[model samples]
Target chain A: MFTAFRDHIEKNFPQLLSKPGIVACSGGVDSVVLAHLCTQTGMQISLAHCNFRLRGSDSEEDELFVKKLAEQLDIPQFITHFDTNEYAAAHKLSIQMAARELRYQWFAELMDKEELSWVLTAHHLDDSLETFLINLSRGTGIEGLSGIPPDSNGIIRPLLAFSRAEILQYAREQGIKWREDSSNEETKYLRNKIRHELVPVLKELHPTFLENFRKTQVFLSESAQILSDYTAQLKENLFVPYHQGYKISISSLQELDPLRGYLYELFKEYGFHSWNVMEALLTAMSGKEIHSKTHRLI
Target chain B: MFTAFRDHIEKNFPQLLSKPGIVACSGGVDSVVLAHLCTQTGMQISLAHCNFRLRGSDSEEDELFVKKLAEQLDIPQFITHFDTNEYAAAHKLSIQMAARELRYQWFAELMDKEELSWVLTAHHLDDSLETFLINLSRGTGIEGLSGIPPDSNGIIRPLLAFSRAEILQYAREQGIKWREDSSNEETKYLRNKIRHELVPVLKELHPTFLENFRKTQVFLSESAQILSDYTAQLKENLFVPYHQGYKISISSLQELDPLRGYLYELFKEYGFHSWNVMEALLTAMSGKEIHSKTHRLI
Candidate 1:
């Protein structure tokens, strides 16, 4: 299984194996397994842990856990604390958004200081499936179905090929200790509802559901790429820069078979998502126009 | 509600409103409500019921129910009996497939002989949601995510704008009678499982789940259309006629960012679905080939 993981990384992302990088380990089973795998594969890797301090002592415990694991493995570790609630209130962002912004911003600085080639996060198959479901439940387009990408710039997901069950099994076998985030059961969170309720039932319905989900993710991602190319050509043919934004030819758009979707895609980059209002604009009076803060469709 | 139904047809499906068409009634609340709405709108619609005789006396009762309803409305009616089991065995198809083939074949003939311009079916929002779930559970691509199309050829679905709950409420208000199909409870089937088990929980999670699903479906369908146009252009650029089959340049294919999906979409017309083996062929020995019964890729 480890060899297969190595082979997948080598084939799809060879650069990660050839150089030193930072492993964003939270001392969870997923990240711990990823770090262990990287060490076993003879990759020069160090651990980075983020303590948002949102979970009180639990946050401090997680930071300490990753520190001990790194020390035990004879590897270097870096830790950071984030004032999540303060940042969220100051920036008018959600707690999740604040934490994500602070964490990634810190990871960037760590990369430059450590001279690491990339950052590896333990985003596994389950995480990807949950993200796919979250987007689906929230009404996403072609691009949303792609799930979590395996490689994005210098950030890579090494454990993406493995499932949560596989990671738990591996951790138990290796006697790995980690902190469990109790917030995982909070149904108020959209991701938790999908992960705890929707995904399990879907998996129980079939023996190979996860494998099939992965394949479907791959298909949607590919279809999205093909659509991007097509939509780019359409934008070029039908849209032009105007006063403060752009003008889209209504006549050309009306000629489309499914005009709503084409119009949606054309104006999507400009922040228009409501299909009903956009659809009505197509047949509105000649002078009718729809406007978002960023762009306008006439 | 009936006025809204009429308005929907007038706005989006004006052809159906202007001419006569066959209403494919199943003697259910859905079709009964649809027929009543058509009459209220002052359109010419005749009910055509397909009695597959799979449900013995129950099937005959449904046929009688539809005939009586047509008589009550003072409209013409058509009924046909099909030997579904024999058809399935003879054609090496499932009973459902056999019934579908038999029903559609008869519909075409009915249309031409009766001089009807189109066929209308009461496939409501709930049915569309179930189909979406069925496709998702079975691991579908963008095309599958599109759900049921609103109009295909001369077939129009006016009732699609309404959900089953709305239709049921309408039926109660109008005191409309309908035959209940007992086979609906047989959860042994996949579609039934999705409708009964999955859809309810999803709806319960949010007040607007179905609405969101519709938006997602429309976006995906549009995306699928754009992708088809793009792939057609790509095939023109990257493929050439060679010997017994077409030749695709492996190098050009390799240049694609998401190669696995592009390759799947390329070979999909040839009935190739597996990507693992097909992906390996990209870097396999130059002479290596992946062959289906109808097509080959070298």
Candidate 2:
């Protein structure tokens, strides 16, 4: 597990260890393992935990466990408690969204306070796969199908290279102890349904479904890059920049292969679902002032 | 009806007089009416029809009816008959897809043969609405939510300015004779399902659903254009064009806002699903070399 963690950091994030960072250690199996690996790798790290106060005693206990673990590892620990349910109600957000917002906000705060260069998390490959499936079920375009990123801004996931099974094996092999969140087992949440039900069925259909899906994402990512380049060229030829928006000469645009994939991408940039909008706009050209809900392209 | 059709042409197809075109006329109310309007307006036009041969005598009757209609109007007529089921079987395409392919192919051919500039169809507002709902049910993104085009390549829909109700009303007022295709009543096809079942339910829920949806498409189209422009600028700064594909500087990309919509559009151009792939990619960057099923991004 330690070797995999170290290798993942080296391979995915070559400069990860060069910067000071805060580890979002929740004392859960995934994060605890990450904390242990960071220490073992001799990286400068601080631990931060957010007690969402969802499970009352369980939440507090989880925070205390992380605090003790931090002491044992000789790392500075920052902890916070929040009325997550109240936040959810006030913001008209789902509990899950509320918790995510709070966690990220708190992590950002901790990073600033400690002057950390990066905020590290322990989202593994399995989590990425789960997210891919969830998004797929929700009627996404190709972009939605691409799955999660390994890094963004100063936020990073150093353990995403390993699967949950691999992480668990590593934790056991290294004699690492961690807490389990009971909520993870509940099927009420969409993610939990995906994790516990949908994925298992999908796995039965294709043993390597998760791995294959991830692979598909990589190909899609590469393809997206090429199409974007083409769109850039097309834009240079057809679009004139304006202060508020742009002026796309209908005649110039008419010269393009209407089926060119990049054209769709270009359309998407203007907040249009390029394909349908282009089709509609192109079709509208034969009619008088075609109006849509918000705008008219005459 | 003729006045509305001429007005539509004047407003939408400002350059229609410069182009000679073929009207895709079946002896149907919509196309027959459209053909009559074009003739009355003295727009150079020829009649084109596809006989899918699905209705035995009825199919032949429709063809004979169109031929007589063209003759009566003193317009040159083009006709093609096809064993649609056989074509579907040979091409391994659904009957609807096969029929569509055949129709468009024949229309294009007639356009070339007659030296016509454009191939005109009778698709109108109601057809556009049905397409939007169908795409939406199939889980389309913004692009899919937009309805059909009025002009694609050299193909144009001069009647798209009016709704189906308007077309029927116009036909009644003009005393136009038309043959109704029995297949339209068959709900086995997805398009038919949308027209017969889904549309009524939707109309009940929102009386102006079709109009509203069309409006939404126009808004999205404008938005898509703006986003494409922004992405082009961003791409100029970050992408290094290579012999085969381009390379994105990780550092430059990292500096952008996480919600940079244009970046997603740019990625989509490369055949990638912009947002999800970027998210997964960014997430993967924090870890060691994560191998998805097919490709590995370090």
Candidate 3:
């Protein structure tokens, strides 16, 4: 498992190993395994811990646990505290949202100041599936189905390929002790509900659900990237820039089999959501124009 | 609900109303509602029924119910019985697959014989979700995530925008008599298991799950279409014909942000399944060539 983890990183993210990066550890099995693997691979790495102060002493223990692990591994460590509830209230956000904002903002600053090349988060396959189900229930697009990306901006998830069970098994075999956040067990939160209630049933129904999702995720991600690159090229090849926005040839577009999709690819950025309105434009009399917030397609 | 159904068809599939079409009815509430609505809209329509004979007397009752309904509505009806088990054994296919093949093949012949423009089925929103879950359990790409398509290959699903509950409620209000397939209630089938055991839980957790999936499906379908178009265009622009197959410039490909997607788009038809092996080819020594049964990319 460790070899697979290391090999995946080397194959997919070789540049990551060349840089001095920080691992965001919550003293959980996922993060501990990631830290251990990075050290075992002899990568230049450090530790970053954020005490959101949401779980009373549990938050402090998480920070302390990470600190000791970092010291034992002879890696540099950084720790910070935040009044999470206050931050959430002041920002008019959920506690989870506030923590995400606070830690990511802090991590960005630390990455720059401490000369760290990348910030690593321990988001595993199970977390990816949970996020997928969460996005499914909530309104989302194709990109949302892509789930938690492996690398985005300056942040990376080296453990994203591993499942929670794999991390737990590795920790047990390696005799690694880590703190568990009690709040994770509470099912009041949607993510927790998914992790605890929904995921197990899916796993039971299809034993290879996670591996299959991994395969689907790869296909989805590649297809999505191709769509992105295609759209970039389409802007140059298809659309002719006009006064305010662009004028797509009505006759040319109508020739496209899926008129709705063509209209969406062309006009979605202009903020038109309804296919009904756009479909009408295709057959509407010439000189008719669609007025959107940012642009127009006639 | 009927108004929305009529409006959705008028906006999306005006071609169906332009000519006479046949509805494939199982005498279920879903198809009964659809048949009522299509005639209600004054469309040129007929009824086609297939009795797979899987449920003995129940199958005969279903045929009788549909025949009576057609007679009452003053519409032409077509009904046939199939030796499904024999067909399944001969074709070396599951009973369901054999039924699907027999029906669709028959539908095609009927369409041609009757000069029908389209074939309608009563697949609805819940069915689409069940299919999405089923496809997720099985490995699939972005197109699989797109869910049950509203229209495909001359087959139109007029009730696709409505849910089963809506169909039942509409049937009750309209005094529509329909037969329920006993096989649908059997949870041994993967689809039934999903419909019975999973959907209700999802609905409880998120009331808008169906609507949200509808929205996501549109985006995925559009994005998937765009990717296909883009990749087709890429092949013409990027790759050069070399030897028996093709040659992609290594320097140009390496400059691409993601080499895997580009290579997949380039070489997928050649039948290379492993992206990792193909990706290694970009940096591999000049003599190394990737092989598939039909073609090679060096």
The C-alpha lDDT values of all candidates are 0.81, 0.71, 0.81
Model 2, stretches more than 4 Å misplaced? Answer: A205-209, A228-239, A250-264, A267-298, B1-298
Interface DockQ per candidate? 0.53, 0.03, 0.50
lDDT of 1: 0.81
Grade the docking of candidate 1.
Answer: medium
Ranking of predictions according to TM-score: 1, 3, 2
In TM-score terms, candidate 1 sits at 0.90
Query: How many steric overlaps does candidate 1 have?
Result: 0
Query: Would candidate 3 be rated incorrect, acceptable, medium or high by CAPRI criteria?
Result: medium
How many clashes in candidate 3?
A: 0
What TM-score fits each model? 0.90, 0.49, 0.86
lDDT of 2 by residue, B1-298 (tens): 6787888889878667777789898788888888888889988888889899988888999999999999999988888888899999999998889999999988877777777788888888778766754543343444454467777797888877678888898788878899997777763466765566545544543456555555554544433344455567767877787655566666666565433334455666644454555665578657644333453334
> How well does candidate 1 reproduce the true complex, by DockQ?
0.53
Could you tell me which 10 consecutive residues in candidate 2 chain A have the lowest summed lDDT? A133-142
Q: Give the deviation of candidate 3 from the true structure as CA RMSD.
A: 4.6
Give model 2's DockQ, 2 decimals. 0.03
lDDT string, candidate 3, B1-298, tens digits: 8789889988999997789999998998888888899998888889999999999899999999999989887999988889999999998999889999999999999999989999999999888888888788876788788888888999988777788888899889888877767887672577777777777767666778878877778777877777777778777866788766566666766665566766766566668754744655644786776667865555
Clashing pairs in 1: none
Tens-digit per-residue lDDT, B6-27, candidate 1: 8898898888767898999999
